[model samples]
Target: MLTLIGGGRDRTGGRGQTAAAAIHALLREEILSLRRKPGEPIAEKDIAAAHGVSRTPVREALLRLADEGLVDIIAKSGTHVSRIPLADLPEAITIRRVLEQLAVRGAVASATGSQIIELRAILVRTAEAAEAGDTEAFHRADEAFHEAVATAGRHPGVWALVRHVKLQVDRFRRLTLPLEGRMARVVAEHEAVLAAIEARDAEAAAAAMGAHVDGLSLGLDDLKRFNPGYFLEDSARSDLKRA
Candidate 1:
C-alpha cells in the first residue's frame, strides 16, 4: 500500500472521479514504471478497494486506459494490462516522427515568447526530474512540454496525432527507463529540440523531432534486454499466459 503525495480522489464531482483518476494514474504509473508486472490481471475490485472507490469509477478508468491500448477489457475475468508488442515499434516510431515533425515546425512558427519560456522551464525541470530518478515527474513534464509545443503551433490536428502516438509509445518508453543514463540523455535531446523551436529554426526543430523519436526506437532493444519479460513478441501474446 504505497501512497503518492498530491495523489488520490478528486471529489468535486462527487462521482468518484478523483478516485478514478487517481487509480488510473497509479495503474498507468505501475505499467510505465514496470511496477505492475506485464500481462498482469488488473481486477477492478482490487483497484476500487485500493482507492476506496466504487466499481463505477474504477471501471470507467479501465475503459479509458483500454482506449489508450494500455489494458484489455474482458467480459468476465477482468481487465488486464496489455503486453508490449515489439514488432509494432517501427510503425509507432514512424507515426511519431511524422506527427512530431509537423508539431515542431508549426509550433516554431506560432510560438510566443512566453510559450518558449514555458517550454524551457519544462525542459529544465524534466532534466532535474530525470536526474532524481523521479519517473512520474519526468513523464509528466515530458508530456506537458510536448503539449505546450503543439498548443503553441495551434495545430489541433498535429496535436491529436501526437497524442495518439504518445499513447502507443508510452508503454514501450516505460521499458526504456532502466537503462543507465537514458533518462538524462532523453532530457538532453528535448533541450536540443526546444532550443531549435525557440530559435525559430523550423527545419532544425523538424530534424530534431526525427532524431528524438528515432533515438527512442533505437534504445528499445537495449531496454528489452534489461527487462526482457516486460515486452512481448506479438506471437507470444496470444493470451498473455506469461509476459
Candidate 2:
C-alpha cells in the first residue's frame, strides 16, 4: 500500500479534475521520485481508499502511468511499476547532451547581462535548497536553472523535447540524489556552465554544457551497483514479472 504525502488525496486536485487527474499526478510523482520503487505493486483498492475515490479513477490513473512507460498493465495480471530499462540510458543521455549543448550555445549568444545575473540568482537558491536537504526544492531549482537557459537562448521549445526524453533520467537522478556530495557536485557543475555563459563564449558554453550532460551517464554505474534490482538487463525484461 502507498502512503499519500502532503495530506492525502484531498490536497491534490483543483482545476476541474476532482478524482482522476489528482490520483494520476500523485502516482506519477511517486514513480518519478522513486518513492514508488520499480516493480512494486500498485494496489488500486488501497489507493482508492486513501484518496477517497472509487476504483474507476484509480484504474484510469494507472492507465495514464502505463502510457507514460512508468507502469505496466496486463489484462488478467496485476499492475506494477516498470523497471529501469538499462539499454535506453545511453540514448537518453545522448539526446540530453545534444539538445542541451545546442541550448547553452544559443544562451551564451543571446542572453543579456541581466539574464546572466538571473541565472546566477537561481544557482544561489539551488545552493540554499541543497543545504536544506529539500530534494523537491532542489529538483525544482535545477529544472528552473535549465529552463532559464533555454528561455534566454530563445529556444524554450527545446526544453519540452528534453523533458520528454529525460523521464527515465529523472528516475535515475532520484536514486542518486542521496549519494554523498551529489548535490554539491551538481551545483559546481552548474556554476561551470554558467561561467561560460557569463563570458558570452559560445564554444566554451557548449563544451561546458556537454560535459555537464555527459556526467549524468557516470551515475548509471553507481545506480546499477546500488540498486541492481530496480533495473533489468536487456534480455531479462522481455516479459516483466507481475507485481
Candidate 3:
C-alpha cells in the first residue's frame, strides 16, 4: 500500500545522486511521517515495480534505512518498518530539550522583527490546526514552530542536530497528538514560548522551551499501555521510569 507514484528521481532525489538515494529519501519521509506504519511489510519487488527501478536499488535504499533504524531487513522474513525504540526516547528528549533551550535563548537575543513575525505566523497556524482538530496538520505546525525558533535564533545547525536525534521521539509524538486535549495543550505551550521570545526575555524563553520539550514524556505509561505493538520491549522503559 506504500506507493511511489512518479518516476523515482524528483525533488526528493537531488541531482547526481543515485536512484537508491532518492528512493531512500522518499521511504524515509514515509516512515518518519507515519504513513508507513510500524511493522508493516515492505516488499522489494513491489517497490521496484512502483518506482521502475531494479531490486538492487530498492535493496540499497532499504539497507540505508536499516542503518538509521527506520526499517528492519530480516534475512529471510522480508523488511518491515521498525518499531519505535522506547529506550531511545528519554535520551533524545533530553538532548532536544537542551538544544531547544539554547535556541530559544539565542532567538530572544537576536531575532529580527521579521523573524518574530514569522514565528507568530507559525503559532497562528498551529492554533488554527489545533482548533480544527487536524492531528497531521497540528504535528507539521508543531515541528515548524520549533524549527522556526531555531532558525530565528540563528542556530539552524542546532535544529538539524535535534532532528537527527529525535526520530523516535517524533514517532512517539505523532501517536500522542490524537489524545484528548493534547493538541490544545501544545498550542498553549507554544504560545507561552513565543510570548517569552516576543518579550525578549531570554531566561523565560529558555525555561518555557525546556518545559515544552519535557512535556513529550508526560503520559508515557499511557502511551505504552495503548500502543504496545508500536514500541520495543526493553530495559528502556525502566530507565525512563527511573528518570
Candidate 4:
C-alpha cells in the first residue's frame, strides 16, 4: 500500500502525514540546494519550529525520508542527510537512459495522434518554461513531459523503476540545474526529442534520449567531487550496517 512510512495510520498518522509531506518538501528543497549540508544532524526541535508542526509530524517525516534513502538514521546519533554516492551516478543514469529510450520507443509505437499532440504541447510549454527561467515550473514541465511519454508507452512499471533510481540522481541534477545557459540547452534537447517523436521516428527518438542522458553523465563532475568517499565500497558497507 501507499501508506506514509511512519506517519501513523488513522487520525494521528493522517494528520502527521499532512505535516510530513510539508516537511518532506521543505527538507528535500534544502537538501537539493545544499543548504542543509550532507552529514548534518537533523535537529528535530529546530525543524519542528521551522515547519510549525508538532514533533510527532517531524519524526514521521524523517522516517519517510529515510525510507526513500534520502536520510540516514543511526541508533544513537539520530538522523542526517544521506550522503549521495557519486560513483553510482553513471550506472544510475545508464539505467534511466535505457528505460527512457525504451519508454520513448514504446510511446511512439503505441501513441495515438491525440497523445502525440498532447505531448508536443507539453514540450512547447517546457521550452517556454525554460526560456522564462522558471526553474520549478521548468522542472515540473520536464517531469510532465517525460511522464507523458512513459504513459503513452502504457508501461507503468517503467515509472516505478525510474522513480526508484531517480532519487539517487536528484542531488547531482540539482547541482547542475543552476549552471548558466543549462536550461536553454535542455530546451534544445527537448526540441530534438520532440521532432523525432513527431516524425514517428522511434530510432531517432531513442538516439536523442540517449544524448540527453549522456549530457548529464558527462556534466556530473561536481557530483563526483562533492562526495568522493561516499562512492566507495566502504560507504555502501556502512550504509548497510545502518540498515
The most accurate candidate by lDDT is 3
Q: After TM-score superposition, what is the CA distance of residue 101 in candidate 3 from its true location, in Å?
A: 0.7
- In model 4, state the lDDT of residue 181: 77
Model 3 segments beyond 4 Å from truth? 1-8, 11-13, 235-243
In model 4, residue pairs whose N, Cα or C atoms come closer than 3 Å (at least 3 residues apart or on different chains), thus clashing, are none
User: Model 2: how far is 179 from its true place, Å?
Assistant: 1.8
Q: Model 4, 85-179: lDDT tens per residue? A: 66577788999999999999988788888888888888888878777888777777878888888888887689779878887676766557677
User: What would the TM-scores of all predictions be?
Assistant: 0.78, 0.88, 0.91, 0.78
Residue 177 miss distance in model 1 (angstroms): 2.4
lDDT per residue (tens digit) for residues 1-243 in model 3: 344534545444367667788788889988988899888989989889987878888888888888788887776567888889877889899999999999999999989999999989998999999999998888888889999999988899999999998988888888888888888998999999999999999989999999999999977899889878888866233222100
- Give the best candidate by TM-score: 3
- For model 3 the local lDDT of residue 69 reads 81
Which lDDT tens digits does candidate 1 get at residues 136-166?
A: 8888898888788888888767767766666
lDDT agreement with native, every candidate: 0.75, 0.83, 0.85, 0.74
Q: How many backbone clashes does candidate 3 have?
A: 0
